[model samples]
Target: MSTTTPGARIEVRGLTKRFGGFTAVDDLSFDVEPGRITGFLGPNGAGKTTTLRMVLGLVRATAGDATIGGVRYVDLPDPLRTVGAALEATNFHPGRSGRDHLRVLADAASVPTRRVDELLELTGIPAAARKRAGQYSMGMRQRLGLAAALLGDPHVLVLDEPTNGLDPEGIRWLRGFLRRLSAEGKTILVSSHLLREVEQTVDDVVIIANGRLVKAGTMADIKGSPGAVVRTSDRAALAGALRVADVTSIPGEDDTLIADTTDLRLVGDVALRAGLPVYGLEPKRADLEALFFQLTEGTNRNETAATAAPPEGDAVTAQEGANP
Candidate 1:
């Protein structure tokens, strides 16, 4: 393995991309810290791929910039040595054997030939190393792609939809591998549409929609905003009491009240003062999937609005058509 530092911070500032008149990414900004897995999450067509491409210097941004360790990808002295990227599973030449494909990359990067075999084994595809990439299964191809990414023993890893074709076991293995890498101080930025998988794997998240940032923070910081669910006799009284105490309570299922604070004792005390018997109080953790949906819903709405808007030069044409 290379003896370079294991992690580097990634910074995206006002990163924007436009395709003709349609904006694909709009001033999106977020930070991916070192020594942790940061999930780059968005629904389909939310510009997650475009943003990643911009970060990797694969796609030029119209308005902003992204950098790793304060250096743009193109400006890196030795890019592959600093950043390893696996954007797609089928990126390898189809005719080449998986081992040969890695060897080619290793040769180009000046990495030792034995490192190719080591990566094949590390990614758990040594048995199929001799198979043509065209004949490899999707899962196997993913493994090979990951092997190629790790060939340089880079400090930073950027992957897009890496779990797309993996079986449950493969996904589980990947989760563990990423965590172990993070523990070793590698900076990891993995993009996924799979919220459940990301929720389990990532330490922090940057959620975007309509090419704009929706939310960004540690998992705890995001989930910490939600409060507790309290069940009490006389739900209406409890609500009134909580309101008096300047704590808001929303009515929940099964005659329970959801308070805006996680403090169970405070909620119980308010209920006691209201002469309402507290039956139960359970912490209501915010569901990451639910929050993801909530944030992206506006993106869909904005997309619709943008799509429906008349082009700048078509205002007269639209008026003429409307009159007809």
Candidate 2:
């Protein structure tokens, strides 16, 4: 095998799972790039959790394998030290304080005790550290779970729906935090159904539907196929001006002036100086979320692909959608 793998990557080859014919996940193949935040995404019951479970060895794969940093997650020495993971916020003990919860995990991972406090502050949960976890809100629990994941300072993160119930502020924080971690060369693999949020967070995305591979690529790949979309603040002038060029002005969100442009930058600049304040101008391409839903649609596609492949190899199927 030439290893046509994920390009010097973290590889998942032919992963499959079943709950006595339920086939939660099947023959999903994909790779997570090193030092990037990769979104593992799908609709409800898309096997996101089941895939994470297989990676954690919590549920054995009926076939295929997932390797982190070139080795199986379980086979890594001091698994916690090699990988940090948070599969579910509900996994935490409700009675434990945020600080104590992290402390226990730190002890288990043999991480320094001071590290717990550092993370409590790092995650903006220092005040909540003393409060009982059970009393914490969904956002608080999610933060605590993140703190626990960081206790080991692992190189790679295997997170499942990390922002599941977080508020917008919390979601924004997670995005920035994950971005910072990736900047530090940490590899993050997070599975989420929040496609728009994932579109903002992930450098690359691996989309699956009904337990199979659909599409996997950098954000650019998803949007590369999207043609030019011109935007300006003065939609009326730009729209009127664009009539001469025959580019249609469609209503786009974000106070935009949309048109199909012959020259993206050229027309964008002309429109702005023409008193149509161009806030931004570029191709309105299909982003990860759009590409995800675009590729993961058809109800039978997932089943057809799953049944076509062996239970032990990698597979990817795509469903996509457009915002407009």
- The CA lDDT at 190 in model 1 is 96
**Where is model 1 more than 4 Å wrong at Cα?**
1-4, 225-228, 236-254, 259-282, 298-324
Clashes per model (N, Cα, C within 3 A): 0, 29
Model 1 gets an lDDT of 0.83
CA shift of 282, model 1, Å: 4.2
Per-residue alpha-carbon lDDT of model 1 for 174-261, expressed as tens digits?
9998888888788999999888888899999999888889899998897767788988768898888888889998898898998999
**What's the lDDT for all of these models?**
0.83, 0.73
User: Which regions of candidate 2 deviate over 4 angstroms?
Assistant: 1-9, 225-262, 265-283, 300-324
The candidate maximizing TM-score is 1
For candidate 2, write residues 115-166 as lDDT tens digits.
9988999899998889989998888888888878777676777788889779
